[model samples]
Target chain A: MSPLVIAFLVLALLICGSALSMLWTKNLLHAALAMFLTMLGLAGLYVLAYADVLAVAHLLVYVGGVLILILFGIMLTNQTNQTNQTNQTDTASSKNHLMTRESSRLLPLSIGLSFFLGLFWLFTKGPWMNNLPVTGDSKLKEVGLGLLTEYAFPFELAGVFLLIALIGATFVAKNHD
Target chain B: MTDIPVLYFLWVSAFLFATGLTILLLKKNTIFVLMGIELILNAANLNLVAFSKNDPSMQGLYLSLFVLVVGVCEMAIALAIILQVYRNYRAIDVDQFKSEF
Candidate 1:
């Protein structure tokens, strides 16, 4: 195997391992940290796929933007009991702050494993496998040019959509009464 | 160095999708479910990037970029909605919601 393949394998292991940990951990903070590692591995995989532009964008959008948003969500939605004031002291610890509840582990794990195996078998058996060599050049210029030229309209639409979504989000999240 | 096979990317993406699905079903917290949804979206984006790596038109890459934008927008809106839900319900756990009926 080439060095590129070795690197790919290493990144894949990182991604899969972290994702599994995200599933396994009950602590929301631990899951978030695992997700950070997963995203890093995914960015590396994007580089391996010759999508350097995407790697940077994914890192910026996910790590910089989305992860922070998620952390805020976790902070805001903490499950503190109002009726039981006495127990509040016990639950106030940092260790118990964001450890959200989950359902039974056995069924979910089995279902997930089955789905993965079925998809794996299907993918390996599928006729869509392509042997074409990957173009190792940086895609930054082509992607930028394409967005301005061929994809300009969609690009503008996405921008407008984003603005509307953000405004609507703020509106929805504001105090009403 | 030989190009990495597209199959490897597919395999990883498939695993991610499965994990996301499991998290969505197993977790009661709305934010955890949202994270699962993010995982699924990223898995799909990875597939697009991998496929476009060898294509001359590179259309998949462009689409994946748009996918990223949409995913972020969705995340923002969903989190905002979750915040609102917290205000009304006092808990973000999906199973905790109850109707007066």
Candidate 2:
């Protein structure tokens, strides 16, 4: 196989494996770690797609910013008595409660695998537009210009929305009086 | 020019999308669910970017860029809400939440 094909395979494995691990693990921390791997794999995929800028941005946003935010959210919202570890009398009951997950197990997995395979087959068989050629050495300049000229309004709106979200988050997570 | 078929990227995206959907449906933990949501969003974004690579207008690229923004917004808002819910209910499991007797 070509180097590009091998790279794609590696990325796909990383993404798929980490996602599966994220689903399999019950420990919140482990799941978070799995998510980190998934994001890393995704960034690599973006780079392979020739979206170096998007790859970098995705790494910054998802891994650096969002993952940290998620970790904080996990810490802040942690249930003190999850599985009620300290109470000896209720240990068995709490263990049962803590171990149980809300998923459909085999059904969902089978369904998901089927959907994926179906889509893959369709993609391979379908006739797509192939006459076009890829262009642009890098998108840093084009994107900057587009954001300022074409997407300026929405860009500013996103900023305002972020501010609102920050304020709203504080309000929502505040200690109950 | 060694141009790979666009279908390869589409297949990858589809697999990611399906895995994400399973996670969304199967996981009880709120954060886990959120991660799944992110996966689905990224899978779709990958599709858009892949298709846009060949397009003269590069529409899919722009759309993916905006999708990234929207995903962040959703993540921030959802995590904040999850934090509040945990504080109130003392549990992050979805099945624990019951509105009325």
Candidate 3:
């Protein structure tokens, strides 16, 4: 296999494996760690797609910002009754052997597998808009220009909305007690 | 056509969506459920990025950017609400919240 394919394979493996591990594990902390790795793989995949700007921003936001936020959440909402620190977050990895808490008798998994297979089939059969001209390398510059020019209004709106949301979150979190 | 196939990205996204759905069902912890939501968000983002790869106008990319911002806002609000819930209930397990009518 080519190096590009190999790289994609490795990153895909990390994303899928960590994500599956996140589902299988019962410990909240382990799932959070797995999520961090999954985000890392996703950032790498974005880079592979030539979205260097998105990759960097994804790394900054998901890995640097959101993961830290998750860790803090885990810390703040301490499961006080737990006797062991590792047990609180690491999940019961060994116990999850081929079985997890399924919501139904072969309904969700069967539906999911069918959906995946259908999508795969559609992808193979449909005429994808492939062979499009690759854009220039400097997406960071283009993104900067677009954010200031065409996307400026929406950008400002998002910022304002984010500010309001953060304030509201703090207000709701704070209690008189 | 460029040699880079979009199927790879689609495959990855499909697996992620599946995993996120599984997490939503399997995990009893409220925080775990939130992580599943994040996974679902990222899966959608992956699709946007993948599609945006071929678009010169970058609309999908722009939409995904907004989605990311919105996702962060959601994470913050949800975590705060979860903290409040923990404070009130002293537990964050979904199974623990049972009230017989």
Per-residue lDDT for B24-80 in model 1, tens only? 989988888998999999999998998887788899999999999999999999999
RMSD of 2: 3.7
What tens digits encode model 3's per-residue C-alpha lDDT throughout B5-75? 77778778878887787667666667888898899899899988888877777888888889999999999
What are the per-residue Cα lDDT tens digits for candidate 2 across A1-177? 778778888998999899888878777778888999989998987777777778887998899988999889877766646355566476555533334266678887888888888888777766766333343445667777887898889878877887887788777767777
| Tens digits of per-residue lDDT for model 1, A21-111 | 9998878888888999999999999999999999999999999999999988887876655433445666546435456788988998899
Off by over 4 Å in 3: A80-108, A127-138, B1-3, B98-101
Which of the predicted structures, 2 or 3, would earn the higher TM-score when compared with the native?
A: 2
What local lDDT does model 2 show for residue A123? 74
Q: Tell me which of candidates 1 and 3 scores higher on TM-score.
A: 1
Clashing pairs in 2: none
Best by TM-score: 1
Stretches off by above 4 angstroms in model 2 are: A80-100, A130-136
> What clash pairs does model 1 have?
none
Give the DockQ of candidate 2: 0.58
CA lDDT of A29 in candidate 2?
Answer: 79
Comparing candidate 1 with candidate 3, which one achieves the higher lDDT?
A: 1
Using DockQ as the measure, the top candidate is 1
lDDT of 3 by residue, A5-25 (tens): 788899999998998788767
lDDT of 2 by residue, B2-99 (tens): 45556667877897899888888788888888988999999999988787777656678777877887788788889888887776777788888778
Best candidate, lDDT: 1
Cα lDDT, all candidates: 0.88, 0.79, 0.79
